[model samples]
Target: MNEEVENAFLPMTSVSSGKGSLVIHDVYCYTNQIVNICFINIPNNKWVLIDAGMPKSAEKIIQGAEKQFGKGSWPEAIILTHGHFDHIGSVEALAELWNIPVYAHQLEFPYLTGEQDYPPGDPSVDGGLVSEMSPLFPNHSIDITEKLNPLPADGTVPLLSDWKWIHTPGHTPGHISLFREKDQTLIAGDAFVTVDQESLYKVMTQKKEINGPPAYFTMDWDEAKVSVQTLRDLQPELAITGHGVPMSGNELTRELNKLAENFDTLARPDSKT
Candidate 1:
């Protein structure tokens, strides 16, 4: 690992099984809110990055990849569950460096291609400081039209055969999650997060809680609940979310189930339409 980049985010954490068949690396980005950029390493030194964290995180992401697969190796493709600013922060830079395509859901085309702007984050919707400060989050679009490829309508993500991408919008118009049927490993983007992102203290400490996306950025509470329930039904054995450490076993399953069962109680916005 690049000591400099790894140390940039102190108390950096990662989880891997000794079986060694599949590995997930967490590249933590400490920014407006802490974000977790997960990279999955498969056999033959090949890998796929789930999301780009904050701006200027490309180097750290590359560093983490190299630590596992040797230097100068690039993923076959960069898959984005959404085009939210934090998630796509270093996408353009990384794609330029690797000369590889960036894949996103078809519904996300507007944001990725600079065709439309996402609704402004609703700071008034919640009381937390992060929610109250949401007005500062970027709502503008990123110009990466040339580098983006539409995900397959069949839901299979390219280069990752064992996994399927599920549409889980609400945090953004086109948010998504990845699931491996064989092992039930899920890479849930912001459809739901594993942290109480609105609290600076929880974020800094990497506290684990299964919650919805940052309240400020989440537009529709009802849809968000449905999205979470859809994911819970998959009964994933392991999950790596966008904002918390990877979770697994009965604990992860129980939390997901609770989130699904009481999504409205836990994640719905107070200001209902």
Candidate 2:
């Protein structure tokens, strides 16, 4: 298949989240700015890519993987937490180049398969420049129909037996987070994040604060709150979210609980679109 990627957005250099992985590697991206992606290492040099970073980032994703697992290594599969532009930006390019399948929650299929586009980001939500700039961000869906696959009904994840995918929507209908029962490590995606994503400074500094998902792109406030509470119930010892540095231990626990309990004040928008 012949594929062409049109990158009209600004491009910034990639940065590592510097969180130091136990089971995951953080490959950060800039769309003109920054976001996070996870490359999870499984046994035998095989791994999985979770949430493609910013638009036009396939090269950075591949390079980050090779740096971790050595040359010529590709993931067994690419699993998306959601179909938002930042999360699935380079999906088509990476999936096609690697000749691998991309898996996402069944509800996310429409967005991934060229069937639907996400609602526009709500720039009215709180934040500064980032939130204000969001209305200009892409909400259009990309078609990767041929390589897209629905996540397993049984909840088991491919290539990583120790981990299971948990349905944690709200940020998007089909959003999911990966959990490892053994260590209680959670890849929370955008269900929640470690930074106040609405703030451009915090994002670039990789600040470590437990906050709700990115406000501009998140449409369902109630579902997002529920998702945060559900994840808090997991009591993740370590959390690697879609943005910011990895947070862990009592700090992670304490902040996550606070966010879940006071989601309205901390996460909910003053006024939504």
Candidate 3:
């Protein structure tokens, strides 16, 4: 008799890879691989999905949603923070699977419709293997024209009455963050993540910190700095960033303030000695 076996290494998942938590009673945050996706509940069994995870993660996201909202659960729509590969990775799949519309800032329409592609990432700007590996990530546009819709100019998030979408560009021309004025809870996209995303070790360990957008992918340092300042002005009591675990209260305040005050040192790659 003869037997054969296969050998392989575990997945690239982080410590919090498959974990989730409730930032509030109705707002749920789940990590899909390295990126975080939000499920915001609305009354009458309705909910919205904010940003999709890494590519080919549609199945995982759907399963998580089913487990979150129970069987047969589907979001009213998908809200894109930007057209970057990581955030919208599973978007096309999820939208097609559920036949739902996808909303994005008009500036992002070109990228989503395959009209334009983002510039290749700048690996020379940051420290980490992830940064060095940036050249491999796709900077090309994705086609999702039929399912795409422009976000409202008034800032109101469709289907979410109390929440507003704030334009937070720099990570991308149309990057945006969602905010709930009442609780001061913010769903900040890559405008600023809660982890040093360009650092492979930090990303893998899920280390928490208030860092600017991934250095390799950020196109405009000046714009990114202003975006962070704008968010800091909001004084959010809680923030669910695109990456890393959710941060709230004083920890969030202190970290955000420090990040804003020292962005040149803390975030700007060119400032490093």
Candidate 4:
């Protein structure tokens, strides 16, 4: 049996919402409302979905997958960056529908199995209405133990041959990012975003800028800073974050290195601000 988080369709949206872009022939990034979910495939062969989208987005994801990989093609598995509500919104549905396994970090098992809740969002963080409204966002965890599997102990992402899962905790204890050394491609799941997720205006416009995790729910600024630095050192030629658009080339190099170098000033909020 599978269970879902209790959440309705959020009113949030972004200019990039509903758009899908191919970071490469194999990696496709799709924005549902405000968050980005990746559809990675070997085209006409096997594929895996990175994260489920916002609540009420199951159909959208199904349709997108069929369009990308063809009708009746289900992913080998669903790989979660973390068990955040938004990221796992459609997990139960998709997992049930496809009869596939869902994998996440073992440290996230408590939340995914409904044994605990994430710390509530902090609305006092700087930026905009998104941050100010954070408290209202759901922090409850849903039970999905039937389909949940911990990522392998060796850091390899199941079914994704060329990719390795890097523990990028901060936003959540089990947050992860995917890196493919062969092409220097990174799929950063909110370890750092390409948009100021705290700013409502910026989120809506989908402005591209390197910023830290969403300030509202991130539990550890210090850990997030280190995760960003870990990713920057990889020198990824292309990166698709969970928010904003895909960033690549010299812009990615310059922006990612800059954000990692100055995370304290650019990302961490003060004691009260």
Which has the greatest TM-score? 4
Candidate 1, residue 267: Cα displacement in angstroms equals 0.7
Kindly list the per-residue Cα lDDT of model 2 for residues 46-78, writing each as its tens digit.
778888876766777776776677889898899
lDDT sort, best first: 4, 3, 2, 1
Model 4 lDDT, residue 268, Cα: 89
C-alpha lDDT of residue 20 in model 3? 81
- Deviation (Å) of 116 in candidate 2: 1.0
lDDT values for all models = 0.73, 0.78, 0.86, 0.87
Give the distance in Å from residue 37's predicted Cα in candidate 4 to where it truly belongs.
0.8
Report the lDDT tens digits of candidate 3 across residue range 44-112.
Answer: 999999998877778889888888899889999999999887788788888998999999999999888
* Better candidate number, 2 or 3, judged by lDDT: 3
Top lDDT prediction, candidate number: 4
Worst 10 residues of 4 by lDDT: 1-10
Q: Which regions of candidate 2 deviate over 4 angstroms?
A: 1-5, 8-33
> Deviation in angstroms for 249 in model 3?
0.7
State the local distance difference test value for candidate 1: 0.73
Model 2 vs. true fold: TM: 0.90
Which of candidates 1 and 3 is the stronger one according to TM-score? 3
Q: Considering only N, C-alpha and C atoms within 3 Å, which residue pairs clash in candidate 1?
A: none
What is the Å distance of residue 36 in model 3 from its true position?
Answer: 0.4
Listed per candidate, the RMSD to the true structure in angstroms reads 5.8, 3.1, 5.7, 1.8
Candidate 1: regions farther than 4 A off: 1-33
Clashing residue pairs in candidate 2 (N, C-alpha, C atoms within 3 angstroms): 30-33
